[model samples]
Target chain A: MNKASSALSGLYLLLILFFLYIPIIVMMIMSFNRSELYLLPFEFDLVWYQQLAQNDQLIGAARNSIVIALVNTVIATTLGTLTALCFARYEFRGKRVLQGMLVPTLTMPWLITGTAMLMFFFWSGIGRGLHSILLGHVALSLPYVVIIVGARLRSLGVSMEEAAATLGANGWQTFWRVTAPLMAPGIVAAALFAFAISFDQFVISYFLAPVGTSTLPVQIYSAIRKGFTPEINAISTIIILASMVLMIGFARFSKFGGER
Target chain B: MTSSARRLRAIIGLSGPTALWLTVTVVLPLAAMLVFSFLTVVPVGGREAAFTLKHYTDFFTRPLYLTNAWRSVRLGLEVTFFCALIGYPAAYILAKAIKGRWREALLLLIVLPFWSNSLVRTFSWTMVLSDNGLLARTIHGILPFAPSFDLLYTYPAIVIGLVQSYLPYMILTCYISLQAIEDSLTEAAYSLGASRFDVFRRVILPLSLPGLIAGSVLTFVPVLGAFMEPRILGGQQAIMLGTLIENQFTASFNWPLGAALGFIMLAIVLLIMGLFYPVLKKHISVN
Candidate 1:
């Protein structure tokens, strides 16, 4: 009975994995296939990727995505880490309310948030473009960064900072020397997470991006809706691989499935 | 400044920037949306706009909008149901049957695709479910006399794609809760002459309810607002509340109507969270 149950478990897991991976694998293979019609007996070629390089619009969008993600990572990581440190060290009066405010950004659908930002930005004359996109991305990412870094701070405990104080180290000195180094792994992991969130963000960017200028995901969305092409498959395969690699690095630093 | 004053300053300096940013970007914008929802027109660029409740009333007065809202709710329920059905068992095996490095690696693998680009992932489904796509070809190769398996641009296609996208969330949440359960509890129940089904129903299932509830809320909320999956997979059949709202902003440029629709969607989401708050509070500690 035990053996039979275990076998059933393995089969179920394998089936789920197959469902998750099949589309990704199909897209990757089709990117390499020479057939425009996605025909079988796959003849491999690099033609679509070569075409992707010359596709100025796609190349430009990809550059915009990377730049926004990098800027978002820097801003979100700094703000989020500081917020996490505050939550870790202090017992302020409005801390609960502040934490509660973070929930809507995480739980509320991006469609609502995106639309709300559009309405507000337009009315307030902030308007739409890359700066508006950056604002939205940072708001979405800050909560995750705080959560990740806060978890690590909790694990590290207050003893080190207290000890630094006893040894005649000032608050600034202690933070820079002791707390910062100890929290480095968590901070790095959170930054990578911020980068991934901003990079992969679609719904928010979709709303904020003006005509002729957009992020890679927004550009890809229009390309898919307007026309179907293997060049899309080429760009998508590259994005999936990049995001997967970033996530693997995150899983390593954060021990995402928990410590062994 | 005194030492105590300096300490207070440090705390403010640490937490102030993030709080201020969230207030500007999240709190104020949502407030602005609420105000816009009550207006007759978008108050922008010399447009003649006035305060009115017509946009909210339009939702009830217009049958098309009402039906689309209902459709979105139903889609949320269906996608959440399927994700739980498939994910709970897989999470159980990973948490209980597997051990050491293998379990960790498998868990990471399950969650990897979730962080990748959702637009790309949704588009990939179009490749598999199209008439001449891989699924149909493989089905024909096996059955030989089977009908063409064209699953694209249908309700089932949307459901399938949504399930694939969200299944990892269910598994991850369930795995966290399941891993915390002790193996000896099951052994003890078995020694007391409880059957496997009885043990699971009475012992394991009750303990894991929080995770299940949390996963359902997480899955349902996003599925409620999903526009991309249905557009790519459902095609003409893809008119949910989300897509309707998207059309208002993107196609029609009726910002007030879109704002009203968005707030209604948010109210529904908040209601679900409130109903599940008691269960979720126990699972997710605030600090």
Candidate 2:
């Protein structure tokens, strides 16, 4: 009875994985198919990818996406790590409330956040463009960086920093020599996560992106809305692979699935 | 400097940038949106705007707005229900039935796609669900007599795409909580002559409720405010509070109405969270 039930549950898990992955797998497969119409006698070709290469709008948007994501990673990870440091080391008044402030951005739907940003940026003269997109992306990403790196910080405790201080190291010197190196893996993982959050972001980019400026996801959104093209499939497949690889690296560093 | 004074400086210095960033990006924007929702017109281009409760009142008086708001809430509940229904069992298997290395690997595989581009993933559903797309083609190939049917551009399509989009959240949350339930407890129950159904009902379900609630909140809130999925997949049937708000900004250029609609949506989300607060407090320790 036990063996039979276990086997049945295993089969169920496989089915769930299949459901989760089928659309993505189908998308990746369709990207390589030669037929523009997605008609399948299963002819394979790279024609769409070749066309994608020549697509300037998409290329420009992809460039904007990378630049914004890169900048967002640096800004969010630094600020978030510092805040996590404070949360870890200090006992301050209103610390809980300060931590609670992070929840709104994390939990509040991006649509509301996006529209609110749109209104504020427009009214406040920040205007809509690549810069506004960056502003929104960094806000959405900061909390995640804090949460992830903070998890790492909590695990490390104040022992190492306290040890350095006991050994007569100054604050800056201890941070530079000790804390920085120890936090490196978590920081890298957090940075990668921030990048993914920004790179894959759509709604905020959608609302904040002005006419003639867009991110890759924003551009891809418009492309899909304009109609389906196999070119989108090629780019999307590439994006999925890139993001998956990044997350796998994150898992390795963060021990995301937990230590064996 | 005194140690306490030095610590104060450090605290301010470390957290200041993030505080300012959130103020500019989140707190102020939300405040501005609230103000905008009350304004008579966009407070720009020399337009003289006055405070009015009309936008909030309009939600009560306008049937179209009311219908869409209802639709958005219903969509949230439906999607949340389906995600739980599908995700809980999968999480159960992963947490309990599976063991060790296989469990870790499978869990990673489940979460891997979720971190990727959601917009791209949503778009991918089109290829599989469109009338002449993969599913249909495969169906006809196997059974020539079957009528070609498209699941695309329908309510069910939006649900399917969203369920696929958010399923990992449910599984991941449920898995975390479920795995924390020690095997010894269930074994003890079994040895005490509890039936499989009884154990699940009395112990497992109650213990996993927090993950289930957390997952529901995670799934429901976004799906409630989702415009993109409905736009891409629902087509003509895409009108919801989300798309309505999008239209106010994008098409109608009615910022005030959109702002009002956005707050109403926020309120609904808060109401759900408030209702679930007691359970959430007891189970989930999100910091």
Candidate 3:
């Protein structure tokens, strides 16, 4: 009976995985297909990818995406790590309110947040473009970085810092020599998360990007809306693979599922 | 500097930058949106705008906005229902049935797609669901006489795409709750003459409610505000609150109406969240 039940569970899981992955797999396979209509018995070629390289618009958007994601990662990681350290180490007045402030970014729908950013920026003369997109992405990624790094800090405990202080290390010394190095893995993980969040961001970029300037996701969205093209398939395949590789790197540093 | 003064400075130095950034980007924007929602026009470029409730009033007086709002809510419920139905079982099996490395690997596999670009994933669904696409071709190859399986541009296609997009969140949350359940508790219930179903209903269900609620909220809120999936998959059928708001901003350039619609969606999301606050508070505190 147990064996039968286990078999049933395995089958159910396989079905779910198939559902989850088949669309992605189809997209990947179609990217290389020679036919524009995604014909079967696949004649595989890198023709679309070759075209994608020379497509100035797509390449420019991809560059914008990478640059924005990198800058957002640095800003979000540094600020988020510091804020998380504050939460972990110091109990200041209104700390609860400050922490509660992070919830809106996490819980509020991105559509609402994105539209609000557009309205506020347009009204306040902060007008839409890459800069506004950067602000939005950092805000969106800040909470995740804080949560991940804060969890790591909690697990690492305060004893290490105390131990360093007892050994006559000053505040800066203790932090740089002990705390930072110890928290390196978590910080790296958080940075990767911020990078992924900014890279994969769509709704915020969609609203904030001006005409003739957009991120990759925003560009791809317009491409999809305009028409189906194998070029889109090629770019999307690269995007998925890049993110998956980043996530696997994240999983190595952080326990994604749980403390195993 | 005095030690106490230095400690205060340290706290400020640590937390100030993020606090200021969040205030500028998140709090002020939301507050500005609230003000924008009440205006007749965007107050910019010497555009004289006046305060008005007409945008909010239109939501009630005009049946179009009201119906679209209802449609979005219905879509949220449908997507959340399907996610729960599919995700909870997989999470359960992963937590209770599967062993160590396989469980970890499977969880990663399930969640990896969620971190990828959602726009790309939704576009992939278009390829699969379009007429004479991969799905139809596969079906024809097997049955040889089945009618056309053109699932694109339909409500179900949107649901399927969204379900695929958001299912990982449900599983992750459910797995967190399910993995926390002690095996001895199940064994204890069994030894007490409780049947498997009874144990699951009484012990497992109650224990996992927090994750389930969190997952549902997480899924439902975004799905409520989703426009891209609907536009790409539902086509003409995609007239939810999200699409309406997108149209106002992008097509009609009516900022006031769009802001109003966005706040309405935000209110709905907050209302649902408030209803589940008790469960969420406990779960969050535990984490």
lDDT of candidate 3 over B171-232, digit per residue (tens): 99999899899999999999999998999999999999899999998899999999999999
Task: Name the regions of candidate 1 deviating beyond 4 angstroms.
Answer: B282-286
lDDT by residue (tens digit), candidate 2, A1-260? 39898888988888988988999999898889998888767888999999999999999999999999999999999999999888888888967766766777777889999999999999999999999999999998888888888888878888999999999999899999999898999999999999999999999999999998899998999888887678999999999999999999989889886767
- Please rank every candidate by DockQ, starting with the best: 1, 2, 3
Q: Which prediction has the highest DockQ against the true structure?
A: 1
Backbone collisions counted per model: 0, 0, 0
- Mark the regions of model 3 whose C-alpha exceeds 4 Å error after superposition: B282-287
- Residues A1-260, model 3: lDDT tens digits: 39999999999999999999999999999999999988777998999999999999999999999999999999999999999999988888868878887888888889999999998998899999999999999999999999889989999998989999999999889999999998999999999999999999999999999999999999998888888679999999999999999999999888776676
Error of 1 at B280 (Å): 2.4
Report how far residue A191 has shifted in candidate 2, in Å.
0.4
Off by over 4 Å in 2: B278-287
Error of 3 at B92 (Å): 0.5
Error of 1 at B268 (Å): 0.6
